[model samples]
Target chain A: MHTFADPLRYASRMAPTKTAVIDGNESIDFAELHRRCRLLAGGLLALGLDKGDRVAILASNGQR
Target chain B: MGVPAAGLVVVPLNTRHAVTELKYALEDSQTKVLLIDRDPGELADCVNHVILIPDAYDAMLSAAQERELGVDVRESDLAGLFYTGGTTGKSRGVMLSHRNLIANAFHYMTTVPQREDDLMLVMAPLFHAAGSNGVIANISGHWEPRSHWPRSIPRSHSI
Candidate 1:
């Protein structure tokens, strides 16, 4: 029953303060990462996106 | 991450491909929204909604309220449509479900092993699966020590 998001979910709850992603100038913890992902999910949902819809990501590295 | 987290499918387009190929992929995949990093130029019109990565993306996130993620998605549901390089012929959208990707992540982590503190550097583009290979294991807290690798890498990578 695992999904790609399961890892993030587990890490955020298990090690909320641990650094999960380190960008160029800053680093974010799992809790912060989880919060952001949730917010981003909310934002997309507010945009009228629905389940099973396709969302394409076109970008170079370090943009996320 | 957000798209799939929201129960939506993500289609990562290869930046190296021609605009025509990209357009073809978008159309073929039936993508509804495009979250891009820079000025989309002609690609702006490809999808119904185009959200700029840093600027508009941040704005959207800032205005966003937390919501339940993956409430309707299942392990077997499609998570992403990875476009092939089309070296032989035309590019194809490879359907990958959430379970498939999770399993793949586990496989990758098992093969190479990863430490909780290891800072991975993605040598390939994020559009490729290789770029996001380390993301799951890192988050999953699987430990495998190479012992001799550097702690930091040049440039930057995002998961």
Candidate 2:
């Protein structure tokens, strides 16, 4: 089954340089967003977090 | 977003809720990690780990390796646990699966005309379902912060 990451993966593949998100003066392309997501996921994994684990994010809307 | 990509369930807490409510939601969901923008006072003890935004959050991302995308996420796997506003009664945790959110995205995109060059202004808090789903619905579109709405809206002549 396709997860939420599919669109990003597909977008990055189709247009890596396409701007995916823009917050204020900063903006990231599809490829960069996908890359950061992977790196963040890897970081979580390195913390021993696995499937079914619960993660909470409390931050305002922004590029970060 | 990264949480679900890693095959973990996300429990987005209402920032406006009181400490009592926050404590209840966290305990009810049994959250493993809490990534907050600031100190949550006594609420910090509710989760196993608390990663502060910007600083600790950035360090966490930079320190670890990249995770392989879509490892073992099933359609039925729980993606998030959204808590109700408790306006009617006690707050309840609304369980949503990967398929559910993806379906919502598809449904939203189908109903709303989204173009490749469209720019979406995110005015609502990302913790809200509508807010988060809005972002997911038009993944291909450029997302601008709400602060830029005043100047950005007029530029989008098509809208």
Candidate 3:
């Protein structure tokens, strides 16, 4: 659908080893990030979250 | 990453907001879940779930299977809701769709492209839309190593 998620959807295959984000002392590669995000989505769904549901995030600008 | 991919709307609350402001956002957005890095305090009572980072969040992800984000999500679907700083009277929620984010990312990339060896240092808090301006270019071309999973990264962390 060419949304913001599209890049991540194909990231694992496009450049898995490429570095995506670097936080203080933490370096995350594409593969791990993608897997985690997908799992996160599922986890939220497992918790009974539905489409169009709202998920709020309140935290500093670190690599969460 | 997950929410937008799965057609859910992500509400990035301003970290600078007070308890009442935070509660108002939660109530107004009808946030079903709250993913926090610090203690939510009373904010925990506002959402259906309060997932603390690096612990409850990791557990939740590991127990669940990978989600199929593209199966139902469309470009026009609302991806995120960025709240204003409230300097202009009442804080408002800026509705941004997948298309909007992707386009913005492309604009950022076109203006300031990231090279293979160039790494982007994220300094802005993600609650601000400008902080996540480089997501598309930063993550679009990466390939997975087909290795272990991560317990720290959020759906929209950094990228």
Candidate 4:
């Protein structure tokens, strides 16, 4: 049983350098991914969106 | 509604579709913002704020050093609007909530031991449950998500 609200954090602290994500041509370590998630979440928040506000992303699934 | 839709309402769109069809969905849903894989100017009839996923999205990620949204989500909030095939000639909207998605995701996670090294490939478009859920679940599990299938897989193997 994991003991954290953000399981991602658990992984990060457990293995910061472990390769976490491999998207076809690129890969990101857990530490790197955590940073990206935070940054993107920040960008979303900067767009004047509140917690429950709807924000639609139409990307076809690469890494955006 | 699934992990991606938790705490938010997502409307999936077909990337292969004509702009006119996309416009109708946008209008019907009153979508505040529309994100597109490509150019949105292909559809001229309707107008709304459009954000095109840029080539630099990855570059931005590489340089990302900030964090914001926490994982806390309410079970009762509206999560997503899944439109059905519309047997009656009009597409129907299926509303899903955060709890619905979280339950499903937890169930899925328990069933599969998605490895930290494994890359989850989303073969379908990013609109449906499989694509959306897989993407977010992969993120939560710390697994890499392959955007393009055969092309991406081979590249990963090479590395």
Candidate with best DockQ: 1
Q: lDDT value for candidate 2?
A: 0.79
3 against 4, candidate with superior lDDT: 3
* Candidate scoring better on DockQ of 3 and 4: 3
* Alpha-carbon runs more than 4 Å astray in model 4: A1-15, B1-8, B42-48, B56-67, B71-73, B113-117, B141-159
Query: In model 4 chain B, where is the ten-residue run with the lowest total lDDT?
Result: B148-157
Q: Which stretches in model 1 have alpha-carbon errors above 4 Å?
A: B143-159
TM-scores (chain A) of the candidates: 0.90, 0.92, 0.87, 0.77
Name the weakest run of 10 consecutive residues (lDDT summed) in model 3 chain B: B144-153
For all predicted structures, in order, the TM-scores are 0.89, 0.89, 0.87, 0.68
Which digits, one per residue and each the tens of the lDDT, describe model 2 over residues A1-64?
Answer: 6675666677778788988889889999889988888987887777788688888877788766
lDDT of 1 by residue, B13-89 (tens): 88888899999999998888998887788887778999988889899999999987768678899999999999899
Error of model 3, residue B16, in angstroms? 0.8
How much is B112 displaced in model 1, in angstroms?
A: 1.0
TM-score of chain B of 2: 0.86
Instruction: Record all residue pairs in model 4 with backbone atoms less than 3 Å apart, i.e. clashing.
Output: A21-B144, A22-B144, A24-B152, A38-B67
| Between candidates 1 and 3, the DockQ winner | 1
Quote fnat for model 4.
Answer: 0.40
What interface root-mean-square deviation (Å) does model 3 yield? 2.2
Q: Over the stretch A1-64, how does candidate 1's per-residue lDDT look in tens digits?
A: 5565666676678788987777788889888988998998888888898799889998887737
